[model samples]
Target: MITEKFRRQLRTEAKLWQTEGLIDDYLYQQLSERYQFDALEKTASSRFITILISLGGILLGLGIITFVSANWQQWSREVKALLLLTLFIGVNTSGFYFWRQQNTLSNTTNKKQKLGYGLLIFGALILGANIALMAQMFHIGGSPYGLYIVWGLGVLVMAYSLQLASLGVMAILLIGLGYLMGLSAVFYPGEFSWLQFIIEYMSLVAVLLFIPLAYWCNSRIIFFLATLIILLALEISLFRIFDFLNHGLWGAIALTLPPALLWGYDDIILPKVNSRIFQAFTRNLAIWYLSIGFFFLSFRAIWQDFILVNYSEISSEIHWLTLVEVLVFVGLTIWEWLCLARPNKRDAQSWRLDLVSGVILSFIVGTAILCFWHLSINEIPEIATFIINIEMFLLAAGLIRIGLARGIRGTFWGGLVLLTLQIVSRTFEYNTGLLLKSFVFILCGVGVIAAGLWYERHLSLEEVRK
Candidate 1:
């Protein structure tokens, strides 16, 4: 894990030692060879050159875009399509030439290589614009999601063909946006429904396309980005599909998805993926999701909104896609549980089991409170509010404990901050007297200051001991 900069520093020290006669010429030569000091020295200037080359490519792209905009009204339909295609092919061909031309040189960080990468980026942008503009020119009618989906697919093809991580990242973003737009469009119907197919299997399509690209590009960022988008699309799609908002099924989802991700991470995801970055990103995301979910559910008004409001009877229409999603989640959870039951895995502290237990408890509590409210229990809301607030507090405490066990400072602070926010927010939200509220606020401030001082003192003592 020796970085290039550290290698260079080591090389400098070796050279100084050789000059002072502390190390022999043979040792210095060996150090140079081992560290590739010669290569490092040349690359020191290559990054600046790369940026300059990339800027040139960007400027060239802007010029083309400007020319097209200015002459748009002057071009015929056929000519417009031809012009877009020409720009797409021409820029990509030039990029390929610059990239292949660098094969003649030994240095990998040459200006030509950078220029090629930049040109490829510019070409990818052009390809996206081409898809949208051409669709408009052809009088094709579809949702914005359809246009983006087409553009994203085009960019994805380029990324896979070139195996460029940067392009792959761009493709992932475009696809994610397309999925989001499609989800939004579902709520707000447009003039056309032709593009609904893209939204139907959005998560599945994104996973299938981008997961392979992530592997091909050898980029952990792309992999996790893809995973995040898939989860999001699944969440939204499932919410609508199940009609969860009407039945308060959001609580079930909020409680389950985080644990499911964690389970997938441990049993299936990590074994196949060789990226620490992806693992860390997923783990943090799970913590944040759970924390936010708990904090959101802590409010009494939320429960009232779900319970007090009269809901209309939703149609019994079957949604096959939603059924598939439900089955998939169930199947995966069962599969993970079976895997964990293996002899070797039995000893492991299972995040899935912990999460399942909590989810079951939350579900029971929520159902009980709802039932009580239905049965004319006036005190149901009060009981539910107290239990939920307690649940939030315990969840925060559990997060801090898990963070301590994992030695993650961010998670620990995140949990503590959540706890603080809940307390402060509730104090203001409730109809407490002014004097009582002021006293509670002052008490919380003192507690925080005292806790800070104690933590500082503990850190000082630990440093002294070290």
Candidate 2:
């Protein structure tokens, strides 16, 4: 009998031949026998070099910081920031110089080729730092708009120079954080304002601009970048709806919301986005309706009353969203159905486990709802909604278990999606008092940390397998 290990090796071999366009019955049999045998060594060498380059960049950066800080007694804050910035400039300049040198080095020996790769890696790191510093210097931290400008330069330049996904990842992450910070400021205002939030969106616009560039260059990093940016932009727009209308309702929309919907468009947007994966970020078709109508309906209410429950503040005759909300919901439901019709590769990968977990959790929720629905009859389906909301807390616990047992990326991401829903569900949620809210938060914290232990166990198992 072929052991699982041997079968896996055969599968790897088959994949290799297919990639090489030498796929045939005989080639298949040859791969099933044994691989080229040098694949592991070649892969290991590449990985080792990648690690060295990454680690060296980190250590060098830290060393520079240490050396400069040790002389802080002689250097001012401006001087320190400038010195750090200059160090980054030097590193990036070296990268620029080395890239030119590569043409000449291409004819060199294997050792020289390895050195070229290392230099390229080092150069990429330097370029990353340079863009980051430039962003910082340009007021990335002080102003919301500044963040976008800096990130724009960083992301665009990094994609062009190294085609590194991590650089793109960093850009997307910063964009997400910028959106989060902007939203938090909007709801909990001190110095942060709508202008700053708009600035955050400006960076999003920049992301849109560069995604095409990344794609034209044939970088897969662009696809993920587009994904992150699209999801993030939709999230920000949704949060704006909350601030403009009902914060709690916004949370509702955020929770039940599907990410693919945010990036869904087939006839025009779909073909356009799909044509260039990097530029394919889409907005849920219903979103166009939801955001515009939501803004108009809630704007006066938010500006005039500040408190939603004080119906006395507004004229009953001047209802803004009389039937719009119903239509929006209907449209959203249809959009979600469309997305479910043609689920992405991620959805297909673990649909069985997802369905199983979802069904079980649904059963659990249905029972819980039956138990609690009578008490919450004062609320409509919103009660079932609330129960469903809390079930996310429980669902995450189960996903942690699945992620551990199955070693599936789908389970891991699914769990995180559920967790995000749980948090989004609670934003500006009706709070009876500090005490109740405190208990609820305690439950959330404890539950997540408990689930994290399972994740840690999964990591341990992975280590053992390695």
Candidate 3:
């Protein structure tokens, strides 16, 4: 899809070309027709008006809510119930009517459509209020998260029916909030509620509920969040189970597995289903995971602490649920490797490993070896720390290299910052003299400036070549 900025730029360039006599009036008219130059102003004005209408609607809704709350205690149960039902039905009916009217009337401005969308969102909020007030009137008691879960599920149903991206996002947030709030009850002794069941299997539930919605809405944000929820849930489950085992094993799995899964998602999972829409998002997430995970692992203290932990007395029995989860992910990871090894049909050359993939694979292997050594010999080698530190540096350099090659400033700066942080951290972590620390800091500053200048030069050269 063409962005508004691009369209505006194109329009300006087309006008310049026409003025310079590079294109005839007929060609200019064709360009105008193709890009719909006349509609740009309309779109901008409609957007401004929509924002005003939405803000006004919000204020009006807030005023009505406050007024009702002020006199809510004076009303009887029957009156309260009737008012709640009427408000819910009336707001939703009006929103639907306006939404349909705008669609049916092509001559109408988008202001009505925007108003309809805002009202629908407001109706969703009112649904939650209605749920809360009705529960109070009926004297129903339960965990607060239970209420959020029900409210979120109701919103999710609306989202599915309407296929509205905003409502889908709202539902995800509500459900995620409920899950977070209910985590304490999951660990501590509490009264049983059906919501607890949902909380326990939230990872699977998020996948089942949000993944399809993401595809249905064609929303990258929803897909990213849903995947994040799944990864977090899996990590939490792993840590809980491995709290009894050697921390090294679970930590390695937690740090490596998610990124590996994300990096290979397109090849291993998506290809079978014939979809690549989310490939870029998954790879970006993988890079983020690796960068952060490697930074933490770069510290010597982390490895030393892992080595010092006493795991002999811990119970060997693993929870069945966590075990199954680990097994499934491990199985998928192995399958991904197999797929990567297979030759591509479109290309004669075998699948070549990219720098990022190589770095990730190396880190995983290094971590696995370190954990295994500690497990079998009951001692972590000093070389293990060195290996991890080297991996971190390599990852940083790799990111910078990839970024410069691709002309992505964020990736380049991300690597530069990571490299600088590692240097600064090491300088502070060790008992170095102040003079040496100051010298290192100065060197880092100079190095960063040099790298930035060189990157800019490289970008300029590439643009010239283009």
Candidate 4:
């Protein structure tokens, strides 16, 4: 009830019990805590600024996507192509600009918030454009193989000028593969009429061109050459499948397959990945590919001899021997899956899904047998396939959402794996035309929803509103 001035004077007088303490632990500790908090408070402000800047970048990216999609369909094909080319150039330009800006890492020390923010904005815009271009191309009519060329050139430009050499080389190789596989389709109407060109003239030329460059400039060119060679071998195998190659030479083909698979290793995929983690991962995959390919080739060579007595039935799949082959294949798959999935799936690159895919593929080898054995797949089960794809797509989308939401790498890897499996599934599926296309849209919607929910959970309404 006393006056405020009187109370303050009373408190000060009462606390003056010891104005100067001799090495008091409590006072020293209190001083230290206050100093620590003062420093922490400064850090907190910087963090807040960073968060705001990141949110701004994300919003800008989404805005670009929304803008493009809103007006996309109204644009013509040539414009779309030009837009994609422009996007590619934009990305490369942004990367090089950032590299130049960030070189020597001194800008951050100099407190150049303006340069940093500018880089982020430009990079986010370029990324948005690239993604939009890819999305448009995904549904675009005619061949998409041409777009791959544009992407390759962009990567090349990014790598040399910006020093992202490994990624650049990797991208170039993928585009090179696209060109090799789809070139005939690009030039010819249908069928691989220029198969020999890929095998003889083209692939060798690529090896000659890329391998030496990798040696001198980047050493990652080995991966490019190796993968291209492996692709060449794969193309050869596909051609052999169509021509019904003689059973006698299957043994030789099986033995020689390992060499083609050697490129599946770090020597091939690592430089493209260009990280210790990725190199190890790719090496593991290479080993797996080699071991599995070896086993299948060896086992098939043995199986081929047993089926020679009724080769015609073997070709048509009425043979009892074909059933035995199926049993062996399934047994191997189950064993492989168990081994791969055991002890909590220690292997990051488990090929279990691919193995399952292979089993289904082998079953499809003889369509008559499949119709007699399992009819759900032989005659297009549109609704069921659609539902399954939906579930799979949801799961993939969920996992990616969770990963990206929490900034976890595992979730990204899982999402990418699921996408790969989906790609494989769709590749094998016979055309259901519009139904399949519609299913893809629904799956993409699920992914969009999941991503939105994750982002919304993390970002405040006010932050997003801007």
Candidate 5:
């Protein structure tokens, strides 16, 4: 997406180009019309006003809430219920009215629209309060998380009705909050609420509920949050059910599975749906996952623990739920891989361009083999450490290469940071002298500056060529 700042800069440059006779009036007009240069100032002003109004509304709402809360106990149930209903209806009605208001000769600004959106958001917050107050009035009792879940569901319905991304994001946060809080109740023996069912299969719920909404709203934020929720839910399920298994296996799966899914998201998941909107996000997340995972693995202490852990004490009994969940995701991944490979697009140049994916796949395989070796045969800690260090270095180098090839600054810097961190971490981790540490730090600093300058120059050249 072209940002407002970029558009503004382009507008200035276009004006300069026109003044210098580099571009004629027609071309300049085309650029102006396409970028809506004339409306930028108006849009900025509208946004500023909207922020001010929203802030004021928040303060006013807080005051009203505080006043109501102070005298809440003095009111009769009938009066209280009536007041709540009236407040909810009145606010939402006003919001809807303003939201649908047309701009007339007398009203040129988007203040009404902004005000309506803010009110709608405020009304949504009021919804949760109303639920809590009504419940309190009737003395209906359940877990706090259950209340949040219900509140979230209500907001979600509102989001669906209005197709508002803000409300959708709010709903996801509320539901996520409830889900996290409900984790405590999962292990506690207590009376079951229907919400327990939602908590149990939150991954499925998040996918079914939010994924469609994400596509409907065309919101990357929603998609990102939904993806994270699903991944976290699945990971939690695995840990909860498979806690009796070897920790090494858990570590291996945790390290490898997410990156694999994310790295192949475009190829495996998007093709079926015929959309690549989230490909970049998934790939970046995969890179981050691998980078962090490899950083941890590069430590000798972690490998020492892996080699020392007794696998024989682990339970052989299986939990069907966890097994099915694992099998489903693993099977899906494998099936998708096969489908992706069925096409005859495997050329040398294609392979070279996809060296990042190749490296990730190799890392996954290598990790699995390492874990299995530790389980099945005796292994040297140093050897494992050395192998992990090599893998980490390769990953960093791959990131740098890919970044340079693709001209992505973030990717390049990510790789640089990872490489620098590795060097520094190793320096501190090993029995090195102060002089050696100082020397290493200085070398890393110089290397970083040099690399950054070169990359910036490369980007400038690319831009010029374009």
Candidate 6:
């Protein structure tokens, strides 16, 4: 993530220090060697080449389309079909030829490999176009979701056969689009009944298919996208199966699953997981979800909405999906706890991190119990606001504590930002006058600045001591 310019500046500083005898030449060499400065420049060059190749491919595709359009009037149906099939096969064959050469040819250079990659990318696009053109030529009916489903499956086959990460990503996107289209059709008024358009089931199928593909590909981008699709599918299933927009259910999910992932991802899941891509995805995804979800819950209006909306209409219907989600959550929670507790008492702190996860686990478990109790008694929503406020503050405080202990600036700033946002939001929500609001804003800004300075000074002192 570090930029080339920054790396260059760092190297220059190291040279200056060496020349001035502030640091030894050996130390300077170590500092210079610590960062892969060449990587940033190489990545930049690769991206530029990719962009240029993409543009050329686009222009070439357009040229072919123009020629085809000009000759369309004279071509018969059979001719058109034959032409489309020929182009599809030809593009893919050419791309594969180049890609194979790039990998196998001993004399092939980086430029040749990039060209191969570009051709493959262009071929993938052509494959999609070919599918749509064929579908149109045959007069295929029904929702566009059907077309997407077919196209996605086609790309998925290619992805699996070729073991291409880009193709895997494309397949996921296409399938997600199809799933969304299907969901829309199922809910479309007067056009289709729920049973008539069982599109949501495709989401489950997608999860089953893509999760394995992600692991197989060992691509973090693909894995992350798959995970998101799974989450979306699960949420949609919750909405459809429950037949109510019960905030309590969502709240329970938000509280338990994200925190479990955030706190136990590295300690529990990383040890068991083989794929570096999956581990990275889990850690980052958990961090973002927990931060954003907790911030959203800090607002009082959210709790008010949960209290105001009634779920009586679908209260009698048994939601099997809810049970599934709960079971999965519980399973993950138990697994995390077991992993955290497996070590001896002597290594407990190393595993548990000052009982931080223990506290988060306790809170999530308590929230889950309340969620189930509220399902029956529905009393928690009435007092949910106070509980959520307390949770938000505590979560923020915990993050700050962890950040300070670990010396992670990002986490520390994230905690400060969340705390500041909570305070600012509550301040403005009240019917305070302009003068009071101005004073409050000033107070917040000054307090934040002072705290930041103090933390920076503390870090500097620690560095000096080291």
Ranking of all predicted structures according to TM-score, beginning with the best and ending with the worst? 3, 5, 1, 6, 2, 4
Q: How many backbone clashes does candidate 4 have?
A: 0
Regions more than 4 Å wrong, model 5 = 1-71, 102-109, 187-191, 247-251, 267-273, 306-319, 344-354, 376-380
Q: Which regions of candidate 2 are displaced past 4 Å?
A: 1-86, 97-152, 188-207, 217-222, 246-263, 266-379, 382-466
Ranking by lDDT: 5, 3, 1, 6, 2, 4
Worst 10 residues of 3 by lDDT: 102-111
Q: Estimate each model's TM-score.
A: 0.75, 0.40, 0.81, 0.37, 0.79, 0.73
Kindly report the root-mean-square deviation of model 2 from the true structure over all alpha carbons. 13.8
RMSD to truth, every model:
5.2, 13.8, 4.9, 18.6, 5.8, 7.3
- lDDT tens digits, residues 1-466, model 6? 4445667788778778888999997787677657654454666779887888889978998998899999987988789889978887887877777676642223324445556666777777777787787777787655677667777778888888888899999988887788777665544423543323335444456556786677667777787787777666555555544345455565455445655644565422543555344554565566666657656655566654653455445343434544565456446656766775667655545544337656766667666565545554565554655665676678778777877887778777878887888778777866888898889889989988997888888888888989
Expressed as tens digits, the lDDT of each residue in 1-466 for candidate 5 is: 4666777899999999999999999999998877778888987878887788879978998999899889888989998999999999898888888887885323243567767888899899999999998999899988899889999999999899889999999999999999999975554425556798778668778878998888778899999899889888777665554355655576456456777777776522543466677777887887787788878878888777754554333433434655677666666666555544444465533213254566778988797677656544665567777888888888888889989999988888998999999999999889999999999999999999999999999999999999
Q: What lDDT score goes with residue 176 in model 6?
A: 78
Candidate 1 lands at a TM-score of 0.75
lDDT measured at residue 332 in model 5 versus the true structure, 0 to 100 = 63
lDDT, each prediction: 0.67, 0.50, 0.78, 0.45, 0.79, 0.66
Q: Give the winner by lDDT: 3 or 4.
A: 3
Expressed as tens digits, the lDDT of each residue in 25-144 for candidate 2 is 777767544533344455556878888987997899799778866886686657757776666566555654554454221233333344544554555455555555555555555555
- Model 6: lDDT equals 0.66
TM-score result, candidate 2: 0.40
> Pairs clashing in candidate 3?
none
Clashing pairs in 1: none
Superpose all Cα atoms of candidate 5 onto the true structure and report the RMSD in Å to 1 decimal.
5.8
Per-residue error (Å), model 5, residue 379: 4.7
